[model samples]
Structures are given as structure tokens and as C-alpha cells.
Target: MGLNSAMATVPTKEKGSDEIDFVRWFSQLEGNLAETLNGVLLRAARPVQVGAASGAQNLASTSAGRLVGWSLREATGTAPGVVRIWDGRDNGGALLACVNLGQGASETQWMAPGGVSFQHGLYVEIITGAGLSDDVEGAVYLGGAE
Candidate 1:
């Protein structure tokens, strides 16, 4: 038997090319090469306040992008709860993901399997179980090309 090896190759563009040509050339590269080269990375984190009942609230108004990771913290609560993320201003939109929190003061974190992108806005909803306080707070992290 014989073993063979293959090497990756990157396409090159001529100097003095137009911006569009440069972009097109970069777009042909594999993986995140183009995004890294173009500096089109994003990372954002913001705190969220839980409502008194099951309700949706606008966590952050972001441009079109993907949510990479998130976290929730029960700053002042003793009851287990559930946190949900949405793709719109309220719970009336699509649900992106949800994280479950245990009883007592604690924090929960989650990351998208392959990153979740939203075409509209980003919202969050918090639902506490019975006998649990609603004074929960936490932060969310988002990342994308925009």
C-alpha cells in the first residue's frame, strides 16, 4: 500500500486590483480566512433584567448577526428558572435558545451549537418557577460578521 498527502492551496490576487476584486478573491478562500482577513468579527456582552412574571424583554438591539454564546445569573433569587432567547423584540417572535437555572442563587451559561443568526432583533424572556423570586439578572454574549 502507498500513502499520499495533499496540501491546501490559497488563491492569490494581483496587486492594484479593485476593492471588489479583492473581496471576491478573499471570498474564495476556505473556512474563516476571508472573515479573519477582512476583520469582520464581532463580540458583545450585555446584562439582562428578568421581569416579575413570564415575559419577554428587549435585551439588546443589534444589527443582523449571529449569537455565539450567552449566560444567565440569578443575582437575587432563590428559585429555579428558565431563560429564553428570541429573534425579535418580544416573545412573540421565534425562540433561538433556552437555558435552565437551578434553585438558589446560581448562574447558567450556553453556547450555540453552530452559532445562531438573527435577521431581525434579539430579545430575551425569563420564566421563574413557583415560589421563586423574579429578581434575576445576567448577561449575554453575541458575535458575528456584522
Candidate 2:
């Protein structure tokens, strides 16, 4: 048997021209790529306060984005409650998170490093114990898109 025939061959996919160009462009850029990306991300980050409503409140009505972080606090400082964050308009769509606050002047904060993606928007439903205020005070950090 020939030495060439005795050797094994492996197939590999070739990189496209666009990908090659992108790599070259990225390499030519000044400063750290991570730092550049971080700066862009920081500029896109936005904070919106949740309305003090007893029922559902529309936090953000954007086309596409994500929920980066959120903080909730009891308004009246009387009882415990829960804040259900939705990934759509009004109370519709998937539930992103449920933050529960303790009784008598409580607060809760949560964060998703990668962010919770949302296509429609964001909504929050506040539920409190009986004889307690349904009002809540907090803000949600929105990232991605406008």
C-alpha cells in the first residue's frame, strides 16, 4: 500500500469571506474588544421606575429588548407582597420573574447578567397581603434594543 493511501484524511469547513473580513476588521480596532463592548452595553442600559399601581402596570413598551435588573420595595411599609414581571404588553406573555418582599419595610433586588429577553415589552403586577398597601416602589433596568 502507498504511504499516501495509508494516511487518514479529515474534512474541515472553510471560513466565509464575510467572517474573514469581520475578523480582520475586529483585529484592526484599537483598545480591548471587551471594553468596547462594555461601553456600548452601558450606553444601551436604561432604568425605568415601576408605577405605583395596585394592579398591572406597563413598565416598558418596546419592540425588542431584555430585562437586565430590577429592585422592588414596599411603599407603605406595612406588609409583604410579590411583584410579577411579564415579558409582554399588559399582563400577557411569559413570566420573567417574581420578586417577593418581606413584611414591614421590605425590599428585593434581582439581576440577570445576560438579561431576560423580551419581544413585546415588560409589565409588573403587584400583589400584597390583605389590609396592606398594593403600592410598590422600584425600578427595572432594561437593556438591548432602544
Candidate 3:
């Protein structure tokens, strides 16, 4: 068999390891992905929400830590970016609970569980300026996962 065909071969040891196709595996190599894009677009909020209006911190609750396994997609054409989430609150302080987006690098992501819980608050804010200026365009997508 040719080199390419050799790598394409799959084994029958299905019980030993979780079988993943080479092409599909490469497609979702960034974390146990449920979405596209080769980077992270979601995660547990910063124990709070990062909002607009110049540093309006939305404090997170205890359950905020439960934010994991989140996934993200892309909303191309929306310049600067758009943060869409399900809003919720806890006590006097509120949290973004589930968040989909990168912190610094494009490939960085953090997610929250869906169906079982929500992203605490549905506060959608995008701050792209001097210090943190990365237009939320092209590769910008958000959704619930895990």
C-alpha cells in the first residue's frame, strides 16, 4: 500500500481506543471540540463577565467554575466580533457563567456545560481597543456544549 493509504488504514481494536478518522480528527484537533475553528471560542467566564462601558466587571458565582467543555463557531463578516450568550444572575453579583471567545490568543478557549446549566447572565459585550484590540470578525462563533 502507498504511504497515504497506510496512514488511512483503521484498526479493529475499537475497544482499546476511541477510533477517530484522520481527516475528522484533524478537523477537530483543538480540544474535545463540538464546533469548528482551530482555536478556542468559549470557556468558563472570569468568575464574572467581561463587559463593555470600560471595565464593567460582572462577578461570577460558585457555579461559574462549572463552566467547561464549551464550544465555539464563527460568525464571519461581523466586524470587531459579536458575543452572544444566555444571561443569568446570582445574588447581588452576576456572572456570564458560559463564555465563548479567546482570552489573548486565537486558539485559546474555555467552555461551560449546556442544557444542565446556563451562562448565568446573558451579557454580550465586546471590547476591542488599544490594550485588547482584536476585531471580533471572520472567525467568531459561540454556542453551548458539554
Candidate 4:
């Protein structure tokens, strides 16, 4: 299941314990604990990294996946290139992020503490600029669900 679907609404505790409903408090705490555990497990899944290539790279084959984080470096080219991340099997889907590399070598890293879920998949690609042999190298951090 997707990260959001797998999660449940945790019960909330009372603002003040005037009445001191012990049973209700306990239930709320238990629910909170389960939610925390689920989040930890989803985020802790092994991460897969995809390298720079001519075309878009499919980081995860699973239909549903999450993007935990990613790190990339761009350099050694006539001009800077852009690193585009998408939530799909290719760049045809929704755009997650687009990092424009500096004229000189530069690096970037993106992370979602709670993780970002995608229904399609995760993809990354380097779009070179003006006869630029830009080498945009990066690794995508994938986790949750698939």
C-alpha cells in the first residue's frame, strides 16, 4: 500500500487532564505509537540510487513508491545542465523537482523527512544545455511501499 494509505489517523489526547480519562489517554497514546512505528518502517526501507545517463532513469519499478532523498553533482561540461526529478516511469508525469546546476561544478541534495509518495514511479534525468557534455551525476533515495 502507499505510504498515506498505510497510515491511520492517530487519536489525539485531551488538552488538559482535568477529568483525567485514563482509558482514553491510553488509547490515544497507543494509536500514536502505532503511527510512529509505521512511519519509521516506511522511511527506513532500503534506498536505491540511479546514476546519470542519456535518458530518464527509472529509480523504482514498483507502481507505488516514495522519494526519501537524493544527492547530485553537476560538472565537466561546456554548460550547466538541469536535473529533473519526476513522479512517473518517465519525465512525462508530474515534476517533483528541477535543480539547475551552476556554470561551474555544483551539488544539490533534496530530502523529505516524511517522504513523498508517488502513484506512478520515480524517475531522474539530466537535460544538457547548448552543446554541453554536462555530467550531472546523482543518486535518488527511494523508500516506503515499494
**Top candidate, metric lDDT:** 2
Q: What order do candidates take by TM-score, descending?
A: 2, 4, 1, 3
lDDT of 3 by residue, 1-146 (tens): 42332134445665554444665555455444543235554443322324432443333222222333223322232333334333444332343333345443223344433322434533333445444433332211234222
For residues 25-119, write the lDDT of model 1, one tens digit per residue: 45544334312424543223333344442453445544445666665656455567677788877777788887776665556564554477776
Model 1 stretches with alpha carbons more than 4 Å out: 1-57, 105-114
Specify the poorest-scoring 10-residue window by lDDT in model 3.
Answer: 137-146
lDDT of 2 by residue, 1-146 (tens): 42322223344465332223444445445323322245563435566777573442455644557678877777766677678888877677888888877764555454555687888878877765675557777778776432
Task: State in Å the error of residue 31, model 3.
Answer: 30
Ranking under lDDT, best-scoring first? 2, 4, 1, 3
lDDT of every predicted structure (CA atoms): 0.57, 0.64, 0.36, 0.61
Clashes of each: 0, 0, 19, 0
- Displacement of the residue 91 alpha carbon in candidate 1, Å: 0.6
- RMSD of each predicted structure: 10.3, 11.7, 15.4, 9.4
Q: Which sections of candidate 4 miss by over 4 Å?
A: 1-45, 53-58, 131-133
Per-prediction TM-score to the true structure, in the order listed: 0.55, 0.59, 0.24, 0.56
lDDT of candidate 1 at residue 106, scale 0 to 100: 56
Candidate 1: 10-residue stretch with minimal lDDT? 40-49
TM-score: which is higher, 1 or 3?
1
lDDT of 3: 0.36
